[model samples]
Target: MSDYLPSIYTKFLAQFPEVAEAQGAVAQAVRERTPFDERTDRLLKLAMAIGAQAQGAVKSNVRKALQAGAGLDEVRAVALGAITTCGFPTAIAALGWIEEVAEAP
Candidate 1:
C-alpha cells in the first residue's frame, strides 16, 4: 500500500488482490499475536530479512524500524549482529541495503 513499494511487488498486489489481502491479514495477525513492541518487531523483521538474504526486505524493514522510532545505531547493530549467523558477505550486503534506505530522502 506504500507508494514507495517496489514496482514488482505493487504489480503482484494489483494482479492478485485476493492473495495480497490474505497476506496482509496474515501480517496483521502476526503483529497482534507477537509480544514485541513495534520497534522490536521491526528490528526482528530486519534480522530475519538479513538472514534470508532479502535485500528488498532489509531495506523495507530499515524504513519501518526508523518509522517505529528505532535509532540509526540500533539499525546498524542489527545488520552487524547478522555477520556471525548469516556470514560476512550477507551481513555486509544487508548493511549496504540498510544504508541505502536509511540515507534516502
Candidate 2:
C-alpha cells in the first residue's frame, strides 16, 4: 500500500483509512507493467492533453515524448490523428506542444 490514487481524490480517503491502501494498490497494479516505451507513451499522452486543452501536461509530455523516440513529424501526425477524433483545435495544440519540445534543450 503506497498512497495517492487518482480515484481517491473523489472518494473515501477520509472515511476509510483502508481506501488509501486499496487505491494505492490499484494504481500500482496498473503501473507495474511497462508495456511500451515511456517516450512513446508520453507522445500519445500529449495528444490527449491537447484534446483536453491541458497545456501544462501537453508541454511536459512533449519533452518526455522527445526523450522516448518520438520525432517531430511523428508527433505532428499524432496531432493530425487527434484532429479526426478530437477536432482541429486539439490537433493544432498538439502540434504546438511538439514544436515546443523540439525547441527545448
Which prediction has the highest lDDT against the true structure? Answer: 1
Residue-level lDDT tens digits of model 1 in 3-43: 28788899999999999999999999999999999999999
**Candidate 2 wrong stretches, greater than 4 Å:** 1-30
The digit string of per-residue lDDT tens for model 2 on 1-105 reads 112233544466667869778888995676567575666667667777878888666666666666677776777777788888988877787787667667755
State the displacement of the C-alpha of residue 14, model 2, in Å, after optimal TM-score superposition: 24
Query: What is the C-alpha local distance difference test score of each model?
Result: 0.90, 0.69
Best by TM-score: 1
Given candidate 1, what's the lDDT at residue 11?
A: 97
Which residue segments of model 1 deviate by more than 4 Å? 1-3
Candidate 2 pairs with clashing backbones: none
TM-score of each: 0.93, 0.62
Q: Global CA lDDT of candidate 1, please?
A: 0.90
